[model samples]
Target: MANLLDQLKSYTTVVSDTGDINSIKKYKPTDATTNPSLIAAAAQMPEYQSIVDDCLLAARKQLGTAATDEQVAAAAFKSLAVAFGKKILEIVPGRVSTEVDARLSFDTEGTLAAARDIIAQYNAAGITNDHVLVKVASTWEGIKAAEILEKEGIHCNLTLLFGLHQAIACAEAKVTLISPFVGRILDWYKKDTGKDYHGAEDPGVESVTEIFYYYKHFGYKTQVMGASFRNTGEITELAGCDLLTIAPKLLEELQTTEGTLPLKLDASKAAAMNIDKIPMDKATFDAMHEKNRMAKDKLQEGIDGFSKALVDLEALLAKRVAELNVAV
Candidate 1:
């Protein structure tokens, strides 16, 4: 009997949701994703110190002595992200998701510029946009930015998505992929009602199921990747999703356990289900998003958390630059 992880992979594309290079080698997911949080965490590990130090040195040399500390630090932060992304790309044959600055979640032009800049950095390193997925928060502006970039041959991964409205918007924008957080949704419901939930009854599972059905029912091409899972059950429940970005811990659990993982989500099954197609225009999107408190709150929280992680990475880089300067 195959492990549950292998069983799940038969039905869905598995994505490693981490910046840890060792874990990526161990799990061997089809694709891998990294945000500020994962990168920041990896930067703190002794094994990854050289990666961060090398990027910091390159960033300092590129900016020269005239650049301010903030400028140098910002340059290094972006460099570190791309540096990690390039390494991940080397390991995964499919695609690697590198996220934009979370602070630009509401700025369409800003997000667009950042996406282009990141893609340019990747290209300079001999990696094309086809191997990269620029991850953006699922704000209206972020969706708009994705829409513009998609037409220009730059692919996007709409992250921190929590609602059907966000999924609909991404589909309408023709974005490359959308990551709907399954565990985070469950966390919100658990905190709100103070009750534990599991399996099919979990709010997170229900949310992804609904979005999966909606996308397939409407014949949308944008991929729906369930993410931020809390348990193996959540991952199993979403077995037949387009993709599943899972953390290392859950991946290990699935790998060690043997079970019959049934396919819970099938596009063909979704297409046959009775589901209504909603027009995802700007007005409708905003209105519907406003009505879903859990989605709205979680989206903002995810952005803020990622922004903080970026800030922490910048501070760490600045400290490293200072230490190197003192040694000189």
Candidate 2:
């Protein structure tokens, strides 16, 4: 039998979900994803210190002694995103999904503006759209922003998606890709029922399976990439998704294990499933959004967490900028 990673790749495109270049290089996934959390973690790594230092130097050069910590932090984030994108591209032949500020999830206009800024930063660094997917939250506003961005030839990866309404909205908006969080869904269900889920019966696994079958049945062009994994079982359960973005820890587990990793999902199986394709208008979308409690709470929670992290990162950057000034 082929290696499990190779076998998994045969059906689903594997995406590395971290800013750690060494891990990505080791696993050699087809694509990679990065967000504020991952970038912040990478920024603290000694090996990636140069990346942050370079960004700090550039910010100082631009703003001189008056540069605020927040501004410096923004520059550091941009610098780190671009640096990660460059490294990811060298390993994955497909694309790298880099997220905009989660703080902008509810602010459609702000999200659009930030996405354009991120892409421009990448372009300035010689990375093109052909290898970049700007990650946005799957909020109604975020989807609308992505819709417009896609029209301008910028592709988006919709993340933090939990509900079918989110997926339906992304499909309607014609997003480049949608990351339906698998592990998070399982977590919600586990908490709700106060019982552990197992194997294919897991709610998280079932959620992605439903989304996958629906996308195929309706011929939706938006790619489905499962994200936010908790364990190897969640990863294996979603074996045949369009793509699966995994953390470095899980990737190492998969790489080391030897087992008969069979094809759990296929186009033929998806095609055979009889599922009604419900077209989502504003009313239906709103109703569906309200009904899914897990999706609703999680979306809000994720946005809030990401927004706060961005603020914290900005504070850290500002302190660094102040130190640089004092040194000069």
Candidate 3:
């Protein structure tokens, strides 16, 4: 019998949710994803120091000696992200998800420009937009940006998704994929209600299951990828999701544990479940999302957290660039 990881792979695409190259190599995920936090963590590591330094050097050559420190840092950050994406592509046969700037989560045009810019960088490096998933926060503005980008042939992965409102919006917008965070939802519920959850009873698992059913029941083309898992049980519970981006620790657990992982959420079953079709018009969507206090708070928190991570990366890059200049 195959390990749990191989069994899960038989049902869904397993994506490595970390920015660490070693973890990606270890798990051998079909797809890989990186966010501000993960990328920032990698930037601080000695293993990734060459990636940072190379990006800074190239940024200097492109921006010239007179470029401002801000300009160099900005260019370096963008390069660092694509550099990681390129490296991940070398390992994974499937796509790599690189995120848009989190600070632009609320600005539609800004998000579009940033998304296009990232894709352009990937294209410049000979990777097509089809191979890259531009990750954006699931805010209305971010969804709108994705909608526009999708039309232009750039695929998007909507992240920080917490509620039906966000999921419906992404589906209606025709995004390539939506990552409904399972563990984060569980975290919120466990803290709010003081109950430890497992398997089908887990709120995070329930959320993703609801989203999977909703998307399937309505015949939406957008794929649902459950993410941010706190335990192996949550992953097992979402067995039939379109994809699941798991961190390396959980991947290791799944690899070592041998068991029969059942298909818990099937599209065929979902299609026959008699669920209500959600109205995703702008006003209705806004109201529903606002009413879901957990979703609203967590969405803001995710954006803020990613924003801080990006800022931290920027600071780290700026410091590295300064040190290199001093050495020169």
lDDT tens readout by residue for model 1, 1-328? 8999999999999999999999999999999999899999999999998998888778779989888767777788877888999999889999999999999999999999999999999999999889999999999999999999999999999999999999999999999999999999999999999999989999999999998888888888999999999999999999899999999999999999996889898788765688777877889998998999999999999999999998888898888888777776
Error of 3 at 60 (Å): 0.8
| Sort order, lDDT high to low | 3, 1, 2
lDDT by residue for model 2 over 1-328, one digit each (tens)? 5566777877789999999989988898988998888877787788977777778888767776576667776677666677778867888888998888898898999999989988998888788887899999998889999999999989999999998889989998999999988888888988899999988998888888888888887888999999999998888888888899999898888888888887776767766778887888778888898999999988888888877877776776677667766877
Task: Give the count of colliding residue pairs in each prediction.
Answer: 0, 1, 0
Mind sharing the TM-score for model 2? 0.95
lDDT of 3 by residue, 14-69 (tens): 99999899999999999999999999999888998998899999999999999977
Superposed Cα deviation of residue 313, candidate 2 (Å) = 1.3
Residue-level lDDT for 172 in candidate 2: 87
Candidate 1 off by > 4 Å: none
Give Cα-based local distance difference scores for all models: 0.92, 0.85, 0.93
TM-scores of the models, in the order given: 0.98, 0.95, 0.98
